[model samples]
Target: MLKTAYTLLPALLGMFLLNGCDSSCCMDVPPASNNGLQAPTPVITLDGQPLQGNLTCDPTTNQTITLTAASSDPDGRVVENIWKVDGVESGSVVVCPAPGESKQICLIAVDNDNLENQTCVTLTANNTQPQEPQATPPLPVLTKGDVDGDGGGLYLQCDNTHDTDSLHLYPEDGPFLYGSNDPKDIKEITYNYTYYKADGTIESGPITTTQTEFNEANDQAPGICKKWFHTNNGVATIKVVMTALDDDRQTNTKTYIYNVADGLLVEQP
Candidate 1:
């Protein structure tokens, strides 16, 4: 007829421009969008219990296991809740994990449309280690030339201006009292004296001397003294601390500084 209708109108206009419209003309599609953004669902708990896979805990009750971080945003509202453990950022969702140690433990979840989401858990700790407490052994160190032994010359025997001076301490290996009669070898020798008065005003006590334990005749009596009253010849210092208290109260101090010259007793270098 008009040359077969002009060859079927260019093959039916090339099938309506390559099928953009075929059985009766139709085109209208705009339905796949994600602009509403939703991604944030991370949760990990412990005291309330839901973790369900790997967790061993119990650091021998040396206590510390809190972990509760949460989050969930189907459309938006989970501003941030991130805690990690082996990857290292956890100042507070608490997880000690060190006795046998195996930590993975994560929680991320960020969305306000910034969209983040994480969740992990491994945490193992409990190989029986927790018993560390035994440290208290250090108290025995007395050496000031073993208590000032040859600078000894307290010649104020009666009274040159004031009196009292029987300061002689002797310990050349005699009286750390381990003599084995064992009440822990019984020791308690304390002598304290501190009188620095040359118008500086200071006087101290403690020297009744029962001299326990090592009695080499209690070192011939008259052990620690200082009761002076001599103003202006100006030399009155006598510190002397000597302490030795064993039987587990464990102590051993020795400090000396003597300079009382009106009749003499020097020792101070």
Candidate 2:
């Protein structure tokens, strides 16, 4: 079970983070004034524009990433920024994995009114092996892309198959909902994604997403990529789990699994 407290206030005022509230706690925060308070928006906007997601990290040293708000209310609104991972409130500046592994992280922004919103991202540590030192060494230059239309469809891609990169799982959709637990907040759905290899070995669990790196596949896609998808040959079976919740706390989770042998591509079942 998750931890709980009377932390409705204080330096530790994010107990009600609401990343996955279960009803009794996520009540509708009063509006800034008379009646209706607008639901908080993600940094990419509720419209689904490309948010700068994905991060290509240096595999040689420890790195630090600062959380960005999907959507911050006007300049000031008595709100607090709460950093979270896998549905728990945490400290800022998460420690990333050393070279050669992929990791995912999530964060939620909450206000004094008890309202909240969230976003998740993935960080793939470089897998480059050191080469003999050269007088004039070449540095890897990463690039990025921007959102297309004024507003359009929901599009996100995760990629790690680079010049000499190895097995990795990539997130293709958003798997987070900040206020899903609160009846009053946007019910962002949570999911379960799994990957299995050709040899029958399987890697599975909640898929986290992160910004993509330059020169890599979908290096220009918005939103974070998924995690827990590290394979030696890049071949595997895939699954996506979607859940629906009923008022009394009952849940209806549906599991959809597929097979993919290339580009994390799924064959129709």
Candidate 3:
């Protein structure tokens, strides 16, 4: 084997010399490396504004936000951009979601060098809801005038049959009976009646009679009712508090003041 290899070596050297073999004939040099190349960083902007930390859409618009991003390879390579919303590819705009819905958006840009630069922008979907109107104090209307001219106490009575009735005032007559039931069959507010007199004192009446519905009526708006009373002929201030019947958990109160001259509320005194 050694003799054969030695004999072939001279022949091979002669052939190479005759063929004019140069340094290029024996080996191949590797191509240039790409390690020196850099992966670009994409510049991301939303609504023409540079992104800073987490981004939120303008609350007033409640609409989609326009996205515009740019990337360069420094090698002057062409760059391609990809946008996504909640991981789904989309257009240059990010759309808002239905009321109470929220989502995210992302963008990825790649250069022609096969090098990729990724930048992601987030868009939070928002649904604004209208504010509810607040409940206000009840409005009350008074039919009868001030206290009686003659010294007289107030009278209040309830009639269940009516459920709601417009209690009328006398034609400048004298005071009616206290808790009067002249016409008969009128139920009074048993346990819930409370009054504040002009004398600056408070009174609670466990009247202990049948209670009439304190529902919405013409005298007062819904969820309100009024109680009439005959008070001192000198002076009387009456206050009525009505509770809301529904889930609103509201209370309404109103006060009435009058002067008494004789036995009735004073009209001219």
Candidate 4:
């Protein structure tokens, strides 16, 4: 009986020591911690106003819409801002919305971890208007002649009362000659003339006759090779002939007939 009791005592002591070791080891181990990591928070705003999740806009009446956001990670991670129109990502600078009557512009803020927070805004635009028409002025008329009909002398005139600016004349046919007067003031007066051949070819210089006060007494001289007839006796003969040379070198001749029936210069032919 003494031997059995001693053996049982050692066994009981072993059981007690094993129980204490298990209890101490289990009790010393700590529960898992949830302190280090946290969810990211993304904040969004527009122009200057805070915004909710997504946005919808009117196409016809809005011109511009701006969106912005603030996003953060509990781990203090760095992030990039991304922009999108509707669902498609866009360039750095956002463009106004398109396609549908209502447009949606979105902006998203993302962390280095690629976690994202997004917000959007809407805008509407109107159509453009048209412009008006302009008016034009009329053209002037041109005519040929000795406008004032001043007889051949120092000053020659071509009428241009209806002309807007200075006058221009060229010989109608071949061998065209052109000239201008000393005082080329169109308002006060200046003249241009052209002589044409039978075939409508230019003959003499389109001589720009000088301007002067009208003198009815001074007979206008004809140009070169011009002829006139005197008809006192009903017989018409060449009475006046203009020389081809300049006026200073020209000459005039008159003829009188002495009829035996009359003493004085009775008639001129």
Candidate number with greatest TM-score:
3
TM-score of each: 0.25, 0.30, 0.43, 0.27
Best by lDDT: 1
Where does candidate 4 stray beyond 4 Å? 1-36, 52-62, 92-95, 98-100, 119-269
Over 1-269, each residue of candidate 1 has an lDDT whose tens digit, in order, gives 99999989999998765555443443453222334476878888777766788777776775666778667788878998888787887753555566887778788989876878898888787888667543232232222122223443241211111101111122443543432232233245455655676675665443434345343354422332222222233337656555545444445554555555543343333
TM-score of 3: 0.43
Task: Quote the RMSD, in angstroms, for model 3.
Answer: 14.5
The Cα local distance difference test for each model comes to: 0.53, 0.42, 0.47, 0.37
lDDT of 3 at 162: 25
Better of 1 and 4 by lDDT: 1
**Residue range with the least summed lDDT across 10 consecutive positions in model 1:** 157-166
Candidate 3, position 126, lDDT: 49
| Candidate 2 structure quality by residue, lDDT tens digits, 1-269 | 12344443442544344243555654675432322454354452212444467666775556665445555654325366666654567765555567677666665666555666667777677887656432221111111212223432112222221111211112233322222222211112244555666676665445733322222253332333222334334536655554432222233444544444433333223
Q: Give one digit per residue, the lDDT tens place, for model 4 in 10-111.
A: 899987754555545657544312223333565556665676544544344434555566666777563776667657786433444553444456667666
Stretches > 4 Å off in candidate 2: 1-35, 42-51, 68-71, 74-78, 86-88, 130-269
